[model samples]
Target: MFLNHGSFGACPAPVFEAYQRFQRELERQPVEFLALERRLPELLDAARERLAAYVGASPANLAFTTNASSALNAVARSLDLGPGDEVLLGDAEYGGMQILWAYVAERTGATLVHRPFAELAPGPRTRVVFCSHVEWTSGRVNDVAALCRLAREAGALSIVDGAHAPGQIDLDLEALGADVYTGNCHKWLCNLRPSAFLYARPEVQDMIEPLVISWDFHAPSFPERHRWQGTINPCAYLTTPAAIDFQAKHDWPTVRRRCHDLLAAAELGLEPLTDDYVQMRGFRLEHPDPPELKRRLYEEHRIEVPVFESAQGWVLRVSVQGYNDEADLEALRVALAAEL
Candidate 1:
């Protein structure tokens, strides 16, 4: 039973076929598929248009990256920081991103503050107000739209880490009003691995500097500056439309509701971190070793879920996708009951 779609999503058969089709085409003629501007550029532009429509953003403002981390790093690095500047983030952010901010603060003379979302008050020196739309650790949903309003009031830029938001919740980036936002298509969207997009508001697009000084950097459009970082595969990127179409064709909204109800029915006998979660739920675990519990769930029970220690404590995070059903959650409950 797989219950960890949030960690890395499971792509559907049809979408994976489209992704593979693109890869095979790339191999057929590397120069024409990759190097030719008319071929690769037009294809990427069309893909970006479809994704932008889905996320509620313009094509010129969205840029593709391997994952949300890289997308956020691009935004994090582009910001001009100094000794007195500060970058504020939530205490319950993704672990990898916590390390990312630490690295940035060490390199530049700036302070990184971690506080609860409600307590995030942008001060004079607060250059960036960073947060996650759906927290990775506690599975709590943050009101990032309100956070953006606060940031604007304080004259600070809002950057949202929306890694788990795309398919799990409806997104309207323009209305969400985050100065910068990045989301993972590979997560809730059920796209291929390592597909994500970073959105910078038109007003702030000029503020973001290109991470890679490649051949496409000189393009007049700011978003196009981020294109063609290397010879890295664009097959996953090309399948965005197919991924979106897959969800739409399956009546995903109804499926999501069913999964959410199924997950809610699981009797884990553990305290929930929050009641605001959707298809995924985070439970407080008191096990002596969280990693050991994770290993036992997988090794002994043949169940797949994420059990790790975070600032929040030993967290047992269970995710429910359209593929998940009552049996999967029941198996997890049984396995967890035995361990506890």
Candidate 2:
């Protein structure tokens, strides 16, 4: 049984097929499909429009990127950080994103502050605040909208890393009001890998530059410049609509509710870290050796779940998707009991 949906999501068969169809079409007519700039732009625009509506943003402000990391990188590099500038970050932020900001601080001589939550008071030198909508380690959901409001009031920009929020929860970018919001379509959205988006408010769009300098370098608009980063396999990006359609056709809200219930039940006895998680939950484990226990669960029981060390001791995260059931959770419970 697969229980690690939070790590890398499993795409449904229909969406996978649609992704393959796009790939085949691209391979059949590489020049005709990808080189015809006018037609390609229209198709991309249509896809972005659908995605923007789904995420509660205007298509003009959204740009597709390989993943949330790439989108965050664009924002991180573009920010005018310098000596004496400070960027506030939540202590529970994802490790990869933390590394990116750390690199920015190292190169630009800016200070990066890590606080336990987003309720910190910004100092005079604080230029921006970085936080996650849904924390990866604890599966905790942060009040990003409030954080953004706090940042704006303090004369700081807000960048929300929403890598786990797309299809897991209903998102309204306008309601969130963050300066820059980046999220993954591949996780809860059940899209193929290398598919995600970045939404920048129109006024703040100019602050971001494309990670790759390409033919669209001189493009008049922000989306135009960043959306067409040097030609690569755009099949995953093109198939995002199909993924969204699949979820809609299957009544995904109901499925998500069922998954959330399963996750809640599975978290019994283990300390609940978050009250806002949907399909995934994180629990504090008493096991001294979580890594060995995780390995043994997979090897001896043919179960797949994630257990890792965290600030709050060992953590065992469970992801319940449409494919999961009570039996899967029971298997995990049995395995954990035996292994631990």
Candidate 3:
């Protein structure tokens, strides 16, 4: 009953085993895997093909990264923004993404503006709005098509963080219409640890630079420039196709809907805290005696639902994934009932 797939995704057993096999193959012949291998690029291309098909994008425009944070950094660090340029973001964005932009603004003197929901009506002055497809901390799904319209009207580029959306929502990246989108395969796709992708429209990809300028920096190919960042574990990226297959094998959409139902039922008081949502139920845990309630639920009951205090009130985030079942939800509810 891992409720916190948002923190670090839980890889399915098959996917984990596949990753181990990749590592084993690498260890079997490091020289072949890294240097002498003739088939590595072809293999990568196949993985990219599968990913592009899943997300509705061209394989050439997508680049694999460790996570959404790193993907956002690559985009943030590359854009040539100076003192006058502005990057509008929402207050509800993940903390890591905000920090990435903060670093860029601090060094380059570009203004990092928070696009207030109050003023979010179709406007014409906002520059490059960075938003999440789904609010991570709060399960509020956004109308991305509408937001894209607003950004286009403002002559702004849109960067969408879709960490919580891949497995939870039905997405067509080409139709989503954001200038750039980043999502985690490890989280929703149930891949091995830290596998994620950044998708940029073909025109946008050239402007975006790789985070780590390795030997591929000067290469002629798009994948070379961004893909070969460092000599870290590439198993996660390599085995993503298997993860996709795993989802397909299980009829992922039905499983996702079932999880959502279970989570909604378990959520006692938590309510939506943000406007863009995909997975997780952000309930208003405004019930009296919140602290003692959560403590007893966790300590005495061994329930593992996430409860935190927010501006709205005490909020409990309930999540259901393939690895979780009704028993897990019932246990959490039982524990909460005891405390509440």
Candidate 4:
């Protein structure tokens, strides 16, 4: 019945219980559970190890973050941007990131350049090349490896926003070769909310400065520096391993393939924007008013989807997750016919 996995992800019942279990343990013994000298570091390190193996990175170079936006802020804010320096970004970057980068550029006197996501070309003044592995707007997967290579060849840092990638697609961060990468474990991976990671290559780890100068400020490594951010719940981070296990036990690859096929069928007459999408597809909406269509679809017919204006016009994106099926698509179809 739920098709908006991209907007908000849900944890499987087992994973949710695991998250709750961790929370209860923390609540019962705050100091013993959260104190660094005790179980907190061990739990986080184990979680990081599992996640690092899942995403293809070293635990030492990986840091847990609240969300992708916060992770990117840590990187973007730490950079010593100055006048004439450029932060090249994809035109279809997420709206939240657009605001974050705009603030960073405004505060640092750096130029933020927008280029096509698929065919980004870095210039001489480019200091950083930022892009999304899977675009949030169109649900199209960009060639992140190629983009990272291009940024490296340009002598610039490559930063990827992978908020939508983690469990949606298989990842090998080392293979992708980006200077910095951030992804959400809650989405697709189905952990809990606000759980994500930031990856920096060992050589470039020192360049990263924690957004908050906390207890770990004098810690020896990048992960240690960003590991403890003051009394924050570690339940979501600790439950990520269980989320990874849930996918493996359920054979998510097969489920994803099935979802992709269902989405393809749903996109048949929807004027699909591109074939690059897997589980999620964006359709070109000819509706006179996109806002009205969106409201009517959800409020009247109970079809929850994103229909909004973008650079390419009004778009309606349909997501096919393991929980979605042909009936959901059929319901959406019936609703669209009635409304349009």
Candidate 5:
């Protein structure tokens, strides 16, 4: 049984079928789908509209990227940072994102400050406050709206990395009030791999330029400039509407509630390090070798989960999804008892 949905989410059968259909259509008429097409824009717009409604953002304010990393790169590279400027971030931020910001800091002479906790009070030199809505490592959910407000009060831009929040929680981008927000559709929205979005408040949209200078470089609108990045397959982006439809048909909210309950129940005996997660729970492990424990669990019990060392301690993270059941949890408990 699979329990690592946080690492890579599994697509529903209907969504996968829809993704295949889009891919087949693209293969049938490559030129029409990619270049010489009159309908491509409409198709993209419709997909974006559906996604925007799902995320509670204006269609004009949202743009599709391959994933959260790409979307974040677009935001990071576009910002005019210089020496003496500070970019505040949390220690719980994704390691890949930390690398991206480090590179940005090196290039622009900006200082990158890492806070031990998610909460931050930006200083005078702080240009941007970057943090995650749902921390990947600890599964801690932060008060993102309040963080954004703090950034605004300090006269700094707020960039929220919401890669883990989309389907796990109800998000209203407008209500959040972050200047820039990036999220992955594949992680929780059940969309195809590499499907994600970036939202910039209308006032700040012009501040973000496309990562790749493409045909839309001269486009008048912000989304138009960033949407079409060269002649790449946009099937994943096109299939998002179908993914949303599939979630609606399956009553994903109830499914999520059930998953949360499962996670809570599973974490009962082994109290998790943090109780802030919706579907994923993280518990401390006294075991010295987390990787070995993970491997043994999979090899011996056919259980799949994530166990790794973090700043907090060695952690074993269990993810509960709609497909998971009590049997899966029981198997994991037995395996962990044997290995750890």
Candidate 6:
């Protein structure tokens, strides 16, 4: 039962069924799917409309990507950074993004500044402040409004990595107002794997080139340059609207509240990292348990969860998505009782 949600994320029966239907249709008419470009504009337009509605952006202002990492890499590499240029970021960001920025900085001579967690203040010479809305290890949601305001005051461009915040909480893109914001539908929205999005305010959109250069090289149009970057599986990208609809159909806000309550009860002895961020709860184990704790959960307990080492401590992270119930959390609680 602990495997019912989170981890790879539990797809609702309807969305999974819809995805299978799309796959069958593609297999049945490969030629037609390939030839969809003449009408691609319309299909993508529909996707944009649904995406914009879900995230509160103008339909014309978003682009699709396989995942959040790809989007972050594109933005990081495209920025015109050189010697003395500094990209400020919180130490708590996802590891993959840190590597991407380091690679870009190596060639361009820009330094990647790891800002102290307490120095959330904005300052001059900070070219880009890349941040995660919620820390992956600790589940501590940042004060984005405060950070963005500081970025604005100091002339730094804000790039938010929102991989865990979107479906876990309500998002108003304009209200967040970062120069670049990227997130994953696959993580919490229950879309198929490799579905994510990048949103840039219209003025800064030109600075982020597509990760793969393709047919839209000469076209000045937004969708032209972004929507059809390459030839690959677009099933996941196209089905995000279905995932969004599935969440609404199930009344997910109520589900999230119930999950939060269950987690609050379970965190009594576990020492949660965040007293405030309640969606993805992280706890410090009381003993130096072997890696077997993670393996045994899957091998014997039929549970799939994540436990990783961080700078502050070892963390057992659990994401409570809509499909999860109190029983799943209870199972983990019982397992901890036995193991630790």
Q: Give me the runs in candidate 5 sitting further than 4 Å from their true place.
A: 267-271
Q: Which ranges in model 1 have alpha carbons more than 4 Å from their true place?
A: none
Candidates 1 and 5 compared: the better one by lDDT is 1
Residue 160, candidate 1: how far off, in angstroms? Answer: 0.2
Candidate 1 minimal-lDDT segment of 10 residues = 209-218
What lDDT does each candidate get?
Answer: 0.89, 0.87, 0.77, 0.89, 0.86, 0.77
- Worst lDDT 10-window in candidate 4: 265-274
Residues 157-272 of candidate 3 have per-residue lDDT tens digits of 88899988777787788888888999998887888877899998877778888999987788765666777777877889888899988988999888887877776656453345
lDDT of 6 by residue, 17-77 (tens): 8778777776787767645455445656676679778988776678888889888987887
Clashes of each: 0, 0, 11, 0, 0, 0
| lDDT (Cα, tens digit) per residue for candidate 4, span 1-340 | 5778998967899999998899899989899999999999999999999999999998887999999988998999899989999999998888889899999999999999998886688889999999999888788999999989999999999999999999989999999999999999988898899799999998788888898888998899899999878778888999999999999999999999999999877733578877898787788889788899899888998888888777667888888888888999999988887877
Look at candidate 1 and tell me the lDDT of residue 326: 85
- By TM-score, the candidates rank as 1, 4, 2, 5, 6, 3
**5 or 6: which has the higher TM-score?**
5
Candidate 3's TM-score reads: 0.90
TM-score of each: 0.98, 0.96, 0.90, 0.97, 0.96, 0.93
User: For model 3, how big is the CA root-mean-square deviation?
Assistant: 2.6
Can you give the lDDT of residue 296 in candidate 4? 88
